[model samples]
Target: MTLSRLACLLLAAAPLALSAPARAQAQGQPQGQASPAPGRTLRVAPHADLRTLDPVFASIVITRMHGLMIYETLFAWDSKLRPHPQMVESFSTSEDGLTWSFRLREGLRFHDGQPVTARDVIASLKRWMGRDTVGGKLAEYTAALEASDDRGFSLKLKRPTGMVPFALGSAVGQIPAIMRESDAATDPMKPVTDTIGSGPFRFNRAEWRSGARVVYDRNADYRPRAEPADGLAGGRVVKLDRVEWVIMPDPATAAAALQTGEIDIWEQPGQDLIPVIGRSREVRVERYSSLPNQAMLRPNHLYPPFNDPRARLALAYATDQADFLAAGFGDERWWKRCGSYFVCGGPNGTEAGAAGYAKPDLDTARRLLAESGYKGETLVLTSSYDIAHIGRMAEVAGEALRKIGMNVDVQFADWGTVTTRQANRGPVDQGGWNLFVTTASGATMQSPITNIGTNMACARAWAGWPCDEEAERLRNAVAEARDEAGRMAATEALHRRLAEMQPYRVLGQYDQPYARRANISGVLEAPVMVFWNIEKR
Candidate 1:
């Protein structure tokens, strides 16, 4: 069935009046605001349903976007990728650089009308450190973290490094979101249901539906910085009174809604549908970032076959990046075949040790599979059917692996279910997965230290537990390098080591353009979609 025909059928079957937005509005609005003005409400059709509210518990983009609406960080990356203070009023370091003192900005209040104190920040950082890759590295150097007073805190480091502020302000996976002390005290592994923050928007928990819609209202009490708005930094001035995220998993339905002006913005329009959608004068397709989003095929290191380095290497040798990129993104103009794990066009982009596996070698793959002692065990490849590109990537990879003479089982489900199953560390027969497809922002993939795929913290690492002491050593060397020259050299060495370790395979890099109504303005060019500063006409 053609996508355009599928879109027409879906739209005809479920009319817009009885769609998710209508059902969502019937539920309820925020406490004080009985009804929002027409232009004050910005309706957005997000790529996926926001099932998980806690960004720390899940590293997915939907949860991260949800968190950004309600939460504020101490520091954030600017347009130039430089760290700038957001919540911190003042900070200082001792001569030895071991003792760091920070004071919270005054008048910072949570949605529940409570003051944001240093104790809350301390607790939030502690909880985040347990799960986030960058936070874990920061935890390694921390000697003690304590609240000096109600609005002040101090971090004492065992040994000084330059990753303190960067770790706190990282806009990558599992951002260190500041929450109330009570809420931050929740177990790191568990989800925090309470949504109280000092950011520009407040999460409307009463109006939130699992698969239908998620809503946020302007935080009337939020204080903007003196500086003008920048990328994920500067003043977060909320222009719209309310932002509604209507969950539309089907691309055709979303495109139809977007064309009809039912939704103000479509976060991710399918690449194949861009040409059709772009023809409308009312809609405009805009590229959010210059850096492309990189696709990855991650294998489980805890299970057999992939547990062996040779088996992992075999998969890398057998598969071609062009196949994944072409299957995932149809337009050649939008996608690039890149071998660099750090992103091809970025500053640290290098294909140092990827030459041997640059193109597919079936003979080498077969030899490696035999040497790894694989007994044709069924390898379960889990993926989400809700996401079109990722689903296509999974199918392409599964077929490629089967051609290399391995028993492969492809499983498809909703994104939320796939993520839940991905968390299971048990065997494949026991609801565990051997492989999964995911993506990371190019902004996060530029540095070896910030990229979660390069993390080798064993049990503490990201989903697939890959442990290598030498890789960790080389990564630290890159982080601790004195100069840019030294850093690049260390990065190349680490890249070489990563190629041998085979933690994850980088499929390719591609641009993800956002489709928005022509009247909507002030959409900031950021790594992720943010609600603040966007105004609907």
Candidate 2:
């Protein structure tokens, strides 16, 4: 699992370099699909394989996009960033604001041909609330979740919580996707076999070949709302009859395929290859997401040396955000130095807590490490080199840490294996990991209320599991604030506490550009990539 061994493995696993003619012939087009059918079938090369099928288990970008395609939510955020009714026909709260009632639109049917019901909605929300960091917090304020009728449900809260609708409609990772009661009853930690959803598209499970390809067919029975498509809200019209997600690990091959018109869209193209794509007359390179991705370095709180706050602070000081930004995004134009726990330029984004860890302070870092304890233990730096940015960031971090006289062990693997390994909480010598690098969409870090990385509740927090009582209290304060200003003030305080805790380090922000052929149209500019309104001309 060392870096050199990992490189050898990658070379062995990658598709061999082939001649242009051979490469073209290898992409066996679907039978009778030689001619472009415009809205019939759209071929795409996603950034990575769809590893986790259950949206509730993993919050990665690809999984979220898959969730958006196959499942429907009661509410959705509009272009104005306001919560709007999607599946919900109407909703209201009692005068006390403690009781909220909701009714779903009529004729909603699952991919399995079963009618959607309120009992399903109640069970689905209950299961989602138990897994999502924000939903778990919101659940603390709820007294009960009950179904009022076949098409309606009611939520009775212990106090006035205005975030109920927003929580259900959150655009962040792991959305509360509506599902049948039978499917929703699966254990939160386990994956469900049922892919049945009532969304605009249905998952073509028969064609899903784990690391190779995945397919989705249009749900003709779906009835879109009257409103026009806007963001993830409004009408979700499935213009393409079939959406094929072909996994190509090699960026050059993906770019070449896009150039040859074998692929309609490349969800994530390496920055260095943008020019190559632009040179192709038929291909167009553009920034696909509304929010820049937030890169992060997470340390395991269960094991040493990061278990100690001073040790975590030392590592944070030794690392430089600019180095990671430059390594991941070569050009200064695509990336920016961000010094905030929350996303910069957003409503709750602030630098209130980013004081000393903005730049590299190797001297201070060494001194702090010495002060914590002189014992030299190897710090495991787990990295997923499959992702170009993540791998570059890890190399930069490893170099920085070595300079500060720390023993470092750099282990490299694919992103899927890295994410799965991060959950192990044992000692590093056994099966646990000390540190890892990853990125989150800005949508996930906008506020303490929706941020999963900031969750500090003991045993119930996300992967890294850094528990800080002060940070937890401040997060609750942010959630309970009555006005926008109050919420902002509380958020700033929470950010300051997080800065002190050093649970995780925010490296920087970079745009992930997507490349597509000119014939494709109606690609929505959203935080999560969507395929509903897109067409192949």
Candidate 3:
């Protein structure tokens, strides 16, 4: 899943105090050492590489989850995606809902043994929203967020945005620990050095060139909430004194490591291995679908052909989700023909989508394409060339669309570039191609709070193509609504518009498969992986 982290953040680790490590588990030897130690280092062979270790910027799968043990979030969501307050004790907002005041739990400290203060929180957030820094989501609505004192902080928004705190659940809202904004302004974070954060584990070293495997050790000053991270994650402690995040590009290799007991955990398992891996009594498959945010196929609304609803609808109509799902994924398991912008149980959850979204009707698709003014012109689909499966899925989706009469052309490229191009796309102003696939994932979020105006209406053209004026207006209403109910209604209304418009053909969610030894315990399963909530068997 892709994660966006605000830069110049905090990370974990404390070499100041060290007691002999205790075995996190009573049953077996420590994860990596011959003699068990509570702080003993554990090794892991994961499917994806760690993107970065900059506390404010590294929000990728391995990095963010690993960082959780190092950095802390104001709030966390459990397996059921429920909120669990962490750093802040109890929080409240002004009547206008534009000013949020947070009362933090006292006596909290960073891994460095530094007292966590309102000053620190204020510093971290301001730096995050200051620019296009990493680990930031509230850059738009935020006008000022300051520390009233050591134990209190207040945030003033440009307008009433209900999703404010909820946005904190995202990767940006999650990391780099805390740092003074003044300090960062003078010496900005570098892409080369490892970052800092406040979590159970602290950064040891990050050598991305070493295959993206990062090593971290328990923070000597670290502490855990006796309460579980969520209902899905029961009581847990930072198990295995140390952690070795080994990079294994091949899913098969990672799976083999799990079978051989070379690695105690596997974060992402290949789709083909899902069925067979679960069959092994030696290993258990914890199916983690929707691990990332929803995977959306956004429209290239700026271009000529896509500027018309008939053309956009034709593309949607031409899409054979069944074939695409089957080719990209062996099973029809995780893929959802969703009508709304969110998942079934997300903040925007409702029964509205079930009645609206369904499988394709080729006859209708063919008719739409015909009416959309297509003289069998070649349509290009831009996608990620890496991640073997997604590249394959893009190809399969391209082919499937052709069956319904789309002169589909597939372009494999980095997703970042593709998404930007697609969002700003419009009209027949000639370019290398047409239609780019955009994907969003990593954490659950409330839209009215997280997304900005630039991202609201297909690159701000609100009137043309699949995104109509109603969506634009509703987005505005959702942003300005003073009450939660009003904002939610607006959010739902806009989501409904997305379904009705069917901007891009929905692909599906990225489901992650986690595997652990039979005796292992404390598996924190949720959209985001919280490693501190894990313990050895």
Candidate 4:
């Protein structure tokens, strides 16, 4: 299917036209609770908070999972990261490949029972256009957004955005379809009392049980697969009336709850409990593949002594991938050798430059560091210790750098703090930091519009010097590729370029290894991260 390629726009068109003021509003109206509850509810606890609910914002896995329930994008990706049409019934680009039109789906109504109009798209994009708006990042790519008809909208591009639809598939695409003028008055991201969305499920009351548990009742509007999914279809709507997501922060406690029936599902199942869950009589164990890298993010590789390609190569050579992988995850192989910035490596994963990839060349490393004109700058490496072994990764990488006449200053921080700091134009005083590992869910691997920019292009923008002009050009190309063939070729080219330059060393890919009891049925899994699709036992 031909997808609509929309870019991030920076200009504001109109507000969401919201109703409520900027004050702290109640979460949502508590209504139609099942038997206690009516709709199916599931429990989930990942390593971190999901990304923002506004699809246009940064594609955080957690946010996507939550937004998955309340929002709909123009294009959607299936389990295999394949783009699938959702909100838009049909869409096509113009002959010149600049303007695009979308035919909206009919009979679609937001949870508030309001008819979704084309203007909604414009307003959503407008709110997202401003700095830090939902799809704020889109401002960099898009020129303007204009609604054409009641049922469709038209997006004009200042530059050719051949990859707009895939972008629309992202979080920004899931913006509020029907916002009141008042809702748009203030920040659109704050929870709205009137949660309006046109999705399979509707928003319900959420109860935060003081870090111990959070329960959410479902809306009856939730429509299930009436037909079969090749075969595993035909379940009566859903089995459970309400899926109470007990946010057990402790993994072991989460497993224990699942075992004791305090909780029905263990979203963040620990490895220690994996064996027990597999053999449990009351629960069921299901397995799935994950993205190749456990820790896949770009580190600022442009600092002086290390800025030299040889120094960067030396760091890569010194890194022990096998030992690092073993320490991070005992048996997680979701990540293979990925030379490119894109995670969830495609068939083109092993293309040209990535063939003979992983080799721990200590001797070569030493030689390269010396050649890089080592003026002796302490390599200040920072990373997220939130993930199991990411801090350990910094240590390992630091040791490798130290071996080659490089003094490494390893500093670790919480994922959110580091991410927030970087998003707000990185640390200034520290000479932009020699090396740092940022936490990116989609970076690890995401579906549909998995361009190299959100994963790597932004890496350039975030690095000490944004990785230079040449790197930006290559990254933009990867983001702007029109078709699969063009995308594949460009991605391969990028992989080769980064590998040659050693922009950031590939630490590990994502293997979303979670624990679930024997009872939970109809749970869908995404390799890298994000777990919104699940059913209760």
Compare the candidates by lDDT and give the number of the best one: 1
Report lDDT per candidate. Answer: 0.87, 0.82, 0.55, 0.51
lDDT of 3 by residue, 381-412 (tens): 77764355566677776776788777877877
TM-score of each model, paired residue for residue:
0.96, 0.93, 0.73, 0.73
Instruction: Compose the digit string of candidate 2's lDDT tens values, residues 1-537.
Output: 243553454344334333434433444434444433545889899987887877876777788899999998888877545678989999999999999999999999998888999999988888888878867888889999988789988999998878887888887767889989998987887876678889999898876777667889888899999998888889999888899887788776776667767679999887766765677789888875666778888888887777788888887788878899888877788899887767888787798867777878889999888887737888888997667878989998889888988888889988788877887778876778988888887777876877778898867788888988898899988889999899988998998888888878888888888898999988877767899888777
Kindly give the stretch of ten consecutive residues in candidate 1 with the minimal lDDT sum: 23-32
Our tally of clashes for model 3 stands at 41
Which segments of candidate 1 are over 4 A away from where they belong? 1-34
Give the Cα-based TM-score of candidate 1 against the true structure.
Answer: 0.96
Cα RMSDs, all models:
2.3, 4.3, 9.6, 11.1
- State which candidate, 1 or 4, has the greater TM-score: 1
- Residue-level lDDT tens digits of model 4 in 1-537: 011111011011011112122101221323443235323445554555432334434344444455555655566545554445566778888888778888877866666766767877667656645422224335556777777788888887767865565456543223323343344334643434444566555544454333233344444554443333211112113444444444434444445455555445554454434565556587654544434433543545444665577776676777766666555555554334444455535444533454344677778877877788876756566666655456655666666667766777877766655544444433436434567653344322332234322233333232333354554566567667778788777766666776776656666454545565555566653433233344554
Q: Which 10 residues in a row give candidate 4 its minimum summed lDDT?
A: 5-14
Candidate 2 error regions (>4 Å):
1-39
